[model samples]
Target: MQAGSPNTRQSSSPASKGGSARRRTPRSRNRAPQSPSAPKPSLFDQVGVTAVDPAPFDQLGLPKALVGELTKAGLTEAFPIQAATIPDALAGSDVLGRARTGSGKTLAFGLPMLADLHGTSARPLHPRALVLVPTRELATQVTDSLKPMAKALGLYVREIVGGMSFARQADMLRRGVDLVVATPGRLNDHVRQGTCVLSAVERTALDEADQMADMGFLPQIRELLNHVPAGGQRLLFSATLDGDVDRLVREYMSDPVVHSLTPSAASVDSMDHHQLDIAAEDKHDVLARIAARDGRTILFVRTKHNADRLTRKLRSVGVHAGALHGGKAQNARTRILEEFRRGSTTALVATNVAARGIHVDDVSLVVHVEPPADPKDYLHRAGRTARAGATGTVVTLVTDDQRRAFRAMAGKAGVKPTATKVSPQGANLARLTGAREPSGVAVVEPKAETNRNPGSGGTRRGNPRGRTGAPRNGGGPRGEAKRGEAKRGARRA
Candidate 1:
């Protein structure tokens, strides 16, 4: 069952409530009052249809081969969002869906687009369908998921995003592609370069529309949409459908069938929230301890510099950690993500860049080293964990000065966390993070060597030895000199 559904209650005990209640004080009077209100029912809920008893995928009239592929992937049943919108999308109707992250929205639109283009021929540089995402990581992931299915149906899928080679993407487009998954910025670049054309697009899907709006890509989105064929089908999916997202829907989607599975804040239900009150000095140690735990953890920082700094600190204490932010090149970002995925790196120190697009499984913990600027960001950061019905914990480290501001932010985000004071070795810390003594061995990263003498007749130059003819910092007595001497001896011989 999906988290926050009517049938499933949050995993909260009476003792937990009592503990949080005791933390309340006169300061609560200054805080904004939370209304005793539930999320308004969606159009689907009012019609008496529910996501609890979704129809089978095969019964939705998907091709038998597609059904076989899904079954092979162990996806015999359809999630609520998929079941509700796939049929309408398959029938060429515009669809506006409101579903939380990890609710199987990808396949809801992907399968339909693929099936619709089953026998269609692709023209060079013009795709038949397009799926626009907000980030490079998301573009890569969405393509990965749909590529196999597209191949089964004799269709080709390619992803175009920034930070990758434009020449290579242009070459691919020149070769011919049926489905183009892209981000708005890069896709616009392709359009201006005349390498990609959307005039032939018969269908379009915008995944995470709300995120695109939040990131200020709506103008580009609007411009891109204006280029598509006038009567093509459009599918827009988002976690919430207000503000700029609603405006996009009204202006773009024509008589779209709306399917909203859960409230915007309901994704937090499967998560256990905690506010750790700690001194500023103890914050790094506490975070390092958490990163050293046995499960996958994503640590959210406020800045790119802090992401890198925290990653280094965690690694110094024997936690396998990596940093992810927009400042890194695409290849580095991809490598860090792969390392995290394959368990080589257990902890990911990241900014908000990874908050919305990343979909790694078994992420058991999410730590907010710094509170986000707003409640929406807080919810998105917390949504990183506790995904797809998996249980996880979200801990926000609030210093004394930040307590009041953070408490109000959490309240606005509809989160009531268990607030407690924590120390370097407190019981609550140990209980939450499986804390133990950190390894004292410091990790040193190897620096890239530059070739000072590139055209010197095959003579290789290494780093110069220190004043005493030894490697720096007692790395080993005369290690560099010994290597140089050996090379000299070999040359003389």
Candidate 2:
């Protein structure tokens, strides 16, 4: 690591820069590029590298101030991913890492980016480092996780995402930020408006790369990468590398250091997986029972409407719940996530779009209200719980008609859940998930969630009533006229 440090130099040299002591290291990996077609897909071998003992954060080539800040945060030791990738990343090698969600990928790449940027100065509209994520929620998360350590090193980190003040973002860029955490679309807007530039970015991290590819952001990502200077350090981390993500590696990265701690498709051993076969009639009662049990639980649904519908049902049944979806305004998403993180909301009903890249601590249970569309969706949904080496349970609710399909999806995702036939009040359901009866009392949603503006334009289209209350100023995402018993009133089949 020290060998590569002396070769690290800013394009314009650090001393010539002024204002905001931001920092970054230049790219200098001497390893020859591997053949693009020869991606090492082995999971057990750790990509042919010798097993390394996890080290203390202070001993990982990061600056002492950063180490001190991390120790203060109660994070004295490096996670497997952080330890495996940090030396290569700090040495300015393009790194491709495949680690499970919540394995601390944020710090795996972030610390190196910050360490590289230490003692450097920022230029207006030219951030020294860039971290791109699939969604605004993820951008916020990365920014929050990195800011404290960056501050310790006298570095500035700013979040640039949509649904925030466009003017405020532009102003922050004009004033010079050291690092920018952003989503692709919003960052492109800033670049188009001439408020930000990538010429000075010494390190770029594409977090959750597979999700971005699945979301169809490759065009925007490629455009953004084109703007950064060639030979800049790159770190790409994802749970899986599908075809599109592979394209990104082949096209942009050179001689990348590969690290795979575990297989993407396999389920972690710490998690307990189960498949609950239930009649459609008893679905609501079983779901409510589980939500009312204990610990932080995330319920996954198929659509934005389903998320709100389930959230309303859970809340009315006396379970404090929140709906999380991409369609909701950015601030609304942030508020709900904060509540869930702080335990104010015991259950979070979410769609696939809104839940990706979310990392909440101590989420003890994950329930799939509906079978996911594909194997990948199933894996990602189950990943919400059992994160960062914590033990948790994943339960998938499957009706008689859905069992075969669910089984097939699970098989492709490399999951073998213990199958059980369970009813609403069955002992099996209660024992496996700690299911119990809800209070059977209606809990009014925050006034903000009950209605929405017609202009917002979603399932709310063609509603008779005029837009009322706050003008969709980042309020709740639900729009239900009456509380009702459940999504369809717990219909008997």
Candidate 3:
């Protein structure tokens, strides 16, 4: 689940609830032949059902204990996507779903997967279920969402992603885990090094398949999935189904049940779209004012450098702002997000990395500090706001030279934004974003917290082995040869 919208998160879950299924043990990645029982679809096709109505949690086939957990969490009803997909998924069908982020797609797949995994136990290093996400942030969020439900079913879940301790993750897998949430790159690294095994994966889900394809993780995804036996339950959920995602369906998924909540490239209907025409010189002032506005606001910049620069400028004027980008260490990224969520940091300036998997409440404004180049990008950035039925304002600061291109992209995005020419402290700017002059007193930015632990990804301790956990000479036949050479040199000396 991509943790769609906050309301979606609190609302969507399995209607019947998850229940345990039979367990099977298989060794070797692709070594065992696929079960003959797997359905083979002669044609790549999708079955759409329009009569999907919301169902209560207790009726959808989930285990009783798991349903209790959902009720405890106040998620007693299934959302549209969950309502559409859960019954088929519980029936062991390969599911292909398309819905925007914040549509509560996480539990739509998660609850049923947990139910099926409940009776099964994993062997050391082999998870019974696998979830491949595009980013570490999304991986963490999915793990969090599934934990309470999984606990009710007596299943264990762990995450494998970069910017975390590689050795610790391997140790957890070795001990045993039921489900593993991971990113493609880090999971592949584990698979190659024999730290994790996918042969036992009876159910696999690909969250955000489109972004994974966009990020060029298709080959690695294929390599990972190849380890799972054929005829296993596979669910693929994406914002869109195109080129690579469709290819994945044809090649990997059997006849799948397709559920689409919105049209492709759909824009959020509740967002107030606006375009501010400003000179390059005036952007800084207008941005500062916007940052100082009431409530949580996120400003999207184009680069990591700009995010940091904008954060600094906002803080210099007494705005509690945090900068987020992929360049920051994992710990830093986590801390910044936590602060924003806790309301200690009201303004977040980030790159495209924050567009997906960041679900927070009362985020009333989303500003495109630098407009995205494409309609897809625009939709994703705008998705950061106006989620789950809450109205939000999305403003893109467009310069004169960029006006034509921005308008064209917006049109392609199915948007006809209100256009205005504004400057620093102008009433138009104030009315649009509730802009007000900042306090103009410098507030020192908080330094990123440091972790002294040896393998938490940011810093290392005094140890012979490092993040990779490989030996000094590399720990193989080559290392032994080098040791022999060193001994011989010592004798000569």
Number of the candidate with higher TM-score, 1 or 3: 3
Q: For each candidate, what is the lDDT?
A: 0.74, 0.76, 0.76
- Residues 1-493, model 2: lDDT tens digits: 1121212311212223222222223223433456879775422233533244677887677788999999899999998788777877876677788777888999999998898898887999999899999877888889999999999999999998755656667778889899999888778767766778999987899999888887777888888998987668788987776778877876777656677766766445678889999999999999999999889999999877888889888988899999887656665678889999999998999987555788889999999999886888887778888888888999999999998988888888888899999998899999999998999887777756323323222111342122234533333443221211122111100
Cα lDDT tens digits, model 1, 261-334, are 77767888999999999999998888878888888899999877788788888888888889887655566678
Residue 408 deviation, candidate 2, in Å?
0.9
Q: What lDDT is reached at residue 294 by model 1?
A: 88
Where does model 3 exceed 4 Å of error? 1-51, 448-453, 456-493
Q: Given candidate 1, what's the lDDT at residue 333? A: 74
Per-residue alpha-carbon lDDT of model 3 for 1-493, expressed as tens digits? 1212223233434342222232222312322345789643211222322345677878766788988999999988988888777767776767778776788888989988888887778999989999988777788889999998998888998888766776788789899999999888777767877778888888899998887887678888888888887757888988766678767876787645567667665546888999999999999999999999999999999877788889999999989999887655567778888899899999999987788667777899999998789787788878888776678999999999999999999988888899999999789999999999999999886754432223532212342122544334543324432432453211100
